[model samples]
Target: MAQQFVDTKIKGDKVVLFMKPTCSYCIMAKDVLSKYKFKPGHLEYIDISGRSDMDSLQDYFLELTGARTVPRVFIGEECIGGGSDVVALHKSGKLEGMLKSIGAM
Candidate 1:
């Protein structure tokens, strides 16, 4: 199921971005995540924009985490919301700690 894939990817990948290639928010989210300077191969971006399964996949995401938008950023299995949320985390000075907690830094 879609939920299974999401869970698997979130847990298996240190940084997972369920994004849409043409989404502005996705672009911004990518930029924000890039600021962390994660080691090579640490950041894994999954662009689901044109994927035929995106609808069901997104629905599953909404149901699983109440997140309805693209760029569903997950850090070490924790759903961290979209671009604004990521920025908020960084601004609050908590993003680095979270990254370090997961050994991403």
Candidate 2:
């Protein structure tokens, strides 16, 4: 079920963030991404905190992304890592290009 949810959410030309509302890393990632103008419905935040199946979801994330960390930022169908990673990408001027490629900006 978790797999299905994640797979469906990340399948298209969208930026999907699997995050917890209170996570500092998640906040950082969100702050960076929010600087951009995404097409409607192109940027999605799936809050994993307080969910009954959160552990299973994180397990699936570990299997799929090699990490169970929040702020799992996906640019289109790619897992672009966590908050610091996103900041790095933004600093390098590659995040915008990525968003542009997926038509999210």
Candidate 3:
């Protein structure tokens, strides 16, 4: 439920990272975000497999993002897609800029 996601971890931050625990791409995304100084409190990660609320919320997230994949990110409620997309943004040196623009980094 939305309330559950709000209660668990993603509600406060402007950028949320929906990721799985054992996913390599997810790990890389986290690393990249950290390397860019996104910092600890600036990000949120959800493991859909472990939490029932997250599993249910994935549908809503997919509906918003139009992508059924882990590592679906949101910056100020803007859906930013999966890992490859995040990596691409980072590679282009635009990811950090975007975070800065949003006052998230």
Candidate 4:
């Protein structure tokens, strides 16, 4: 079920962040992503902090992404690692191109 949800969201959205509301890394990711102007409904943040199945979802993410960390960032069906990764991408000036490629910019 978690896999299905994750898969659907990743495939359907231009940008998706499987995050926890209170996580510092999640906040950092959100901060960076918020700078972009994504079409309405194209950017999604799936907060798992309040869910009863958060652990299972994280477990699924570990299998899918090889990491159990919050703020699992995905761009057009690609898991782009976490907050630090996104920040680095932004720093390297590659993030804008990636967002543009997927029509999220």
C-alpha root-mean-square deviation, each candidate? 1.5, 0.7, 2.6, 1.1
TM-score to true structure, per model: 0.89, 0.97, 0.81, 0.95
User: lDDT of candidate 2?
Assistant: 0.92
How accurate locally is residue 76 in candidate 4, as Cα lDDT from 0 to 100? Answer: 92
The lDDT values for all models are: 0.83, 0.92, 0.72, 0.90
Flag clash pairs in model 3.
none
| Order of candidate numbers by lDDT, starting with the best | 2, 4, 1, 3
Is candidate 2 or 3 superior in TM-score?
A: 2
Residue-level lDDT tens digits of model 1 in 28-87:
888888888786777889988777778888998888779778889888887888988888
Candidate 3, residue 87: the lDDT equals 93
- Of the candidates shown, which would achieve the greatest lDDT relative to the real structure? 2
Candidate 3's C-alpha lDDT?
A: 0.72
On residues 1-64, what C-alpha lDDT tens digit does candidate 4 reach at each position? 8888888888634999999888999999999999989988889999998888888899999998
Question: How big is the positional error of residue 41 in model 2, measured in Å on the Cα after superposition?
Answer: 0.7
Question: For candidate 2, lDDT tens digit of each residue in 26-87?
Answer: 99999999999999999999899989989999998899889998889999889999999999
lDDT of 2 at 52: 90
Candidate with top TM-score is 2
